[model samples]
Target chain A: MSFALNGRPGVSEATRERILRIAKEMNWRPHSAARALGGARADAVGLVVARPVETIGVEPFFGQLLAGLQAELSAKSIALHLMVVEDTAAEIEVYRRWVSEHRVDAFVVVDLQVKDPRIAVLEELQVPSLILGGPGRHGGLTSVWADDRKAMLSVVEYLAALGHRRIAHLAGMPAFHHTARRMRALRDHAKRLELIDAVSIPTDYSDAQGAAATRTLLARSPRPTAIIYDSDVMAVAGLAVAAEMGVSVPDELSIVSFEDSVLTRIVHPPITALVRDTFALARQAARSVLAAIEDPGSARDLETATPILTVRGSTSPPPGDAIHETV
Target chain B: MSFALNGRPGVSEATRERILRIAKEMNWRPHSAARALGGARADAVGLVVARPVETIGVEPFFGQLLAGLQAELSAKSIALHLMVVEDTAAEIEVYRRWVSEHRVDAFVVVDLQVKDPRIAVLEELQVPSLILGGPGRHGGLTSVWADDRKAMLSVVEYLAALGHRRIAHLAGMPAFHHTARRMRALRDHAKRLELIDAVSIPTDYSDAQGAAATRTLLARSPRPTAIIYDSDVMAVAGLAVAAEMGVSVPDELSIVSFEDSVLTRIVHPPITALVRDTFALARQAARSVLAAIEDPGSARDLETATPILTVRGSTSPPPGDAIHETV
Candidate 1:
């Protein structure tokens, strides 16, 4: 039998009370109630990609991460509010609008640089955020990042064992926290291996830049026998450059790269690379972001990713006596 | 100036009357009144990717398209909601919830199958939608599609001009609309050119599937001198298979592929490919979806894309005396 309450037919007092109580508990309003109230903001999650669109599309990392986040959110029936900002300043503005307008429940931060300003902005606004990269060197927010230093060392050691003495690294922007760590690790590992010279070239993490950096490295008086690129796209560019210059891969110029994107596997000679389980990383990041949004106190926790090196055909012994040229 | 309407706050009676009249005329709530009634259902755009997360990450097309959409949406202060579903049924369910719950303003539909069920679902609900591929043989939906038939024919003619008579196609699933169109075009164009023995091998659009398809084609009685693939990743896999089989590219077998992804240019013996401006496609889809939401009547308009052929080093004439054997 249906009961009546609040001057409405077929509505029960107990049911109405329960509904109101749950709405208050969740800080949510019924769609009809919201419509009655008029122009009310909705509960959503905000994702700010702190990179240009052109750059983001060419990189495989963001695509996987976004896919994972979408998978989790779809199950919960939660909405993801995505924004692509050109720089950190623009990112700050987007987040401010989202928070002030009550447009989102949480934020997903990516590509964190050292002394990241977003962390400070998020803290001031008390906005729950989960960072895809580390909490930066200073550290104060929830973060999920792959072990770049260890991953770099693994590749370095692998190349060194292949009898390479002079190795050059084509790294991402110098300001990136992970880039600094990766560079340091490469240098330290090279020293430990008794390599004569270990040089680093900074790049903007694009294929064009990667190719240019590789060209400079190759033009050195005595070229490095092996090169390690910060990204798979760059590695692919390096491969192309090597081919263009008539340098035979794994013979005249061995190459190792990071990211392990599809490009690495598709090249005529598959590149030897460090493959981070980006799918796993994305899943972990999604889980962490959800946790941070649910329990703000958990925002201090950091998740670290371990990278595995997948060897293909890109690396081999240096040509003739060039292995020890720098030494 | 302060204005009073509906027996609340007033400075000028005429101004209040005008404001109320305008609100009624537009069938909308006043901005100030709406702002006061906060926390309602938000306006957002939803993107449903009907593909596995594991595979989506490796594909370059999604990444570029997503970035382009994000770029455009961010300018309009609109949020992009992303969801990844395993199949068509799951994608439809996600859309249903979003529509019934008013979680999104419109949807970006991707990877449409031959007789996509999602189209019917969207139509039944009268939800605004923009398809990323051809609207299929059963039209009645807005779609942004690249001319796959023209693209395929161009590849064939380009290879044929290079004196490649024994051409083969490594295509996507037989059931896919684009794949079917490309396959039909390959057969018809081959027939027109008197290359009666041309072959088309269907694949699942993955590297492994591509490799297997290529192997099967190569084992034919009179192997094809030039192979064309539906995707760049599959093309890469074909290259690997060719290498494993000790076939020299361009000398023994020429290759052409679709999607001028980064891998196309980076691989050794770079692949000649058809390049679709993914950025432009994504932007167009975003615009169409937004337009559909604003004006549902225009949702059935068809948007066509032309694929451009970029020649690299992957094509060459059939090996000496091999053409006669195939004919």
Candidate 2:
């Protein structure tokens, strides 16, 4: 049967035709389990996300990224086995179970943590896994990552050039490795630029937190002339907060989104953003993971192009004598 | 092995303990395929979506809905086999393949069409499938749906009462049964209330289309005093269009989003929306599909609660003399 199916030399053409006809008549297809038993590809990839369920819906990043992933993965008829877990512990448990059960050919690890336990777990499982974030601390695993430090530094330089000396960063969860990288970039650059006030406030990447942080920042005695948000949803929420508080965007206060999406482009005064094509990034990640699965240990750490600053309607020169703020 | 692992009456406690310890030491687990061969559950559900990949990412509905589905399905360790296909044909192909391969125990079909082909395919396959949107035309499959017509009628009633007679609807794809339902409900209710110039314009539900539609509508002579959007992303985009065109929301033109998310709430002059908890709806769908999987024909059609009107800062009576537009 294998010879016939593979068109091997031993199988006669007549026998092959008969076998194929019978298989068509019986609607026979290779079961994923049978394939697994034969040590063939499972034709599935596992993506276990650890985030609050509520946050997953409103955030556009995952939705767009999944689109790119699904587009690439579906062309090969490989299903994406997605599971949203509560935390990293549950995430690791999922990886372990899937590995032991031979449920998937590969895993796409996302939301890289500062001290990720899943790295050790995946290494022990000896599964072909691709990390979605990071150039380091991934423990010999292949990674596809955008340079967060470089992107953040470019955003700061752009803002500083616009005469924004006092800037506040609305960052995502502090535990994420990319988040740490972004914060460090901002802290180091702010000191180098000799800024009067530079601060980083970490949030859970929720619009509610974004709004609350924006309100607090704007209410300060000499409010920061600019604010940078980690996500597009947060940037839009912050813009709404600015609108409600009567602070004119790009006039009194400039805003920049670290991530870009339709949310950033559609809002009033259209947010300035560090634009990295997330869809393309996810497609590249998908291709890399597929490669890793096909030839284990062949996928290497890939550093994607840094996000370029696209200055939209949201950023401009700061208010009052801030022209002197430019170094 | 089964008797000892199950701790059956014939198996001694010591024997069962030894069996379990040995199994643990050997790092053995029940293979999903082995279970399938034994006619047990596949422990997975299939959700094949047919939509443009670009739309999937920007749209918040699927993201939120998937979050809900994952939360419920994860508790039982049932993986969601998600596949995004190009169209209905590809979607049906995936269903057939997944069914024949025994990859999923059940299917959760969404985006019900005016003439849904997948319904018949699932029924013929004798698979336990649940439709996500439908109170009708489902052909014996269990469904979990909110009242789209009733929800639309209520939205129209609310808007008409606010003196918006010249109302326009920015609808989603006309091929969708729910889209047709909502459009019909708006048309029927408009005539019943004796309103003037009520119309619906179908769109692909992108922010680009939403903005374009808004611009085209706003530029018309005696343009609509109110516009109802099918999605929150579109509503926000429409709001930005109004701002760009110098049309004040709820002053000259009121806006309402049929679906709501943080996008609606976080925007400037927060949009009024028909609030249905999509997360809750998805959980219900997950439960319904799981039950359908457990007892092949037991799951029944369930109509969830109709979305309630949540009027925020975006709705108001029409401007000036148009107050008399109220019936």
Candidate 3:
């Protein structure tokens, strides 16, 4: 049992591999209680999503991320125990339980809110976890993330170059760490292209809100010529709203989504999107947590990939107002 | 422990409720070993998805079902442990692990293939499980399902009424139990309509495959006047392909997707889709598994809802072919 449970010097590497294969084939796993008594190492990772269960279907980002994360973990023979909690409090409670009971070796944390409450909870338990966002405030945990600021700058740069002097960013929930960071970057970049009017619209990342925001933006006397959405769902929604209002895409307006997935490509006049490998990032997050579990010293925070802006049918020279909007 | 576990008469109902709440809030789940020794009631549910993990982003159906299932499970404080396996053998292996270790009280199963191997595995283990499709070839497992055959018939009937005689069903992988059922029904309904050309094209539930299928169907000398896709992604892809092929939607071709979600509604010329409440169906599946867990005798297979067709911009009288092929 000891030979199988831990990678130790006593067992030959080949023998250990054989033992693991046989054990796996026989469906042998250390019982939770027995493993607890045997001391730590649940041989699994846990992720408790604090978002409401309703959000899972509306957002492909979560599904894509988990697919990548799960693939990496499963390849390492690491089981992912996922839980859906209603809010942060429920999430913290699950965290405390998993930590106290040693139900998981480490955790893959996501949905980073500003001054996230779960951070302190995980810190108190001293469990090794890897956050899937930038290290905000303080850190007991390492992280893997894309350069959101750079990505935001590029989106603004692309729109500005397309003669879009008045651009609006349909931002995700205003309070998230990444959302705030991206919004700041948008403002900073917009300022660099002076006389450019970039208004940030705070949104809850829903299709309804996205459509409502679309109506609000387009109804303005001097409506923004281009709009960048924080999600594909919102972008797709905005596109539908544009069509409903008789606004010809790229002729009357331009639509760009922050994340590229199936939705972006499947839409008519495929959206110009900032494409990132969410799957690879998820895999990296999984690997980071495992590394933290096995050898804490070797684990380091990572910035996985640089998101690239792809111009599909969404961007064009701003409709008749690019030069006129300049101060 | 017995009072809380068994809900025996010794404990007051209020006290039982309070005890359960506290235990859950405390994340103080009874250890699986202790539960095994005590006999029955693991207080958790398992769902093992047997598909390539990469497909999660491309498919919205999985996320929608999980969201609904998770909500129902979370309400009862029943932990949901999800696993992803590549094939039947891996899925069976997961079942064995969960069964032997009492890791889950019951399971929610999806993706029922023809002559499914999981049924044999589940029957041998006698673990309480609820399949997520119609009760087709009869197995020990109970299921909660929407009326898929009726849904298919209605799609063909609507298209026929729209003056589309050369209609094709863009079928999901034909090996799936539901796909075969829907295809058979589509053929039967079309024959009743006396259409000269009514065919089913198999697809792998990916946008690329959907587009390729669409191209192949359209390139034929006498192309399908209308097409019904297996998924929203496929329908959306078919719509894009139609645009690229210079065939106007609902004019040169009418399009319908079998499963409806945000994707169907968001696209330009919004797809005429058979809208089933997948979320509610999933909740029913979750409840079915839970009921089976609490009392095996009380659980029975259920037929839940009938899917309804919603006509949108994508379906209309076929352009020139509308008059030619009618009986």
RMSD of each: 6.5, 6.5, 7.7
Q: Compared with the true structure, what per-residue lDDT tens digits does model 1 show for residues A151-184?
A: 8888888878878888899998878888888988
lDDT per residue (tens digit) for residues A1-327 in model 3? 434335554445654555445334333445444555455466568888888688798799888887988888776656677778888899888888776656678888887877887777787777788888884543757788777888999888887777778889999977688898899998877767763578889988999999999999999978888999999999999999999999889888989999898898888889999999898888888878878887765546687777899999977777675556666
lDDT of prediction 3: 0.80
Docking class of 2: acceptable
lDDT of 2 by residue, B95-206 (tens): 8887766779999999999898888898998889999988897989999999999999988898888777899999998899999999999888788776888899999998
Q: Which stretches of candidate 3 lie over 4 Å from their true place?
A: A1-37, A297-299, B1-34
Ten-residue region with minimum lDDT total, candidate 2 chain B: B22-31
Tell me each candidate's TM-score. 0.85, 0.89, 0.89
Model 2: residues with Cα > 4 Å off, grouped in runs: A1-37, A322-327, B1-37, B324-327
Over the stretch B40-71, how does candidate 1's per-residue lDDT look in tens digits?
33456888777776677777888888888877
lDDT of 2 at B234: 93
Which scores better on DockQ, 1 or 2?
1
lDDT of 1 at B41: 30
Descending-DockQ candidate ranking? 1, 2, 3
Candidate 2, residue B160: lDDT: 81
Clash pairs (backbone) in predicted model 3: none
TM-score rank order: 2, 3, 1
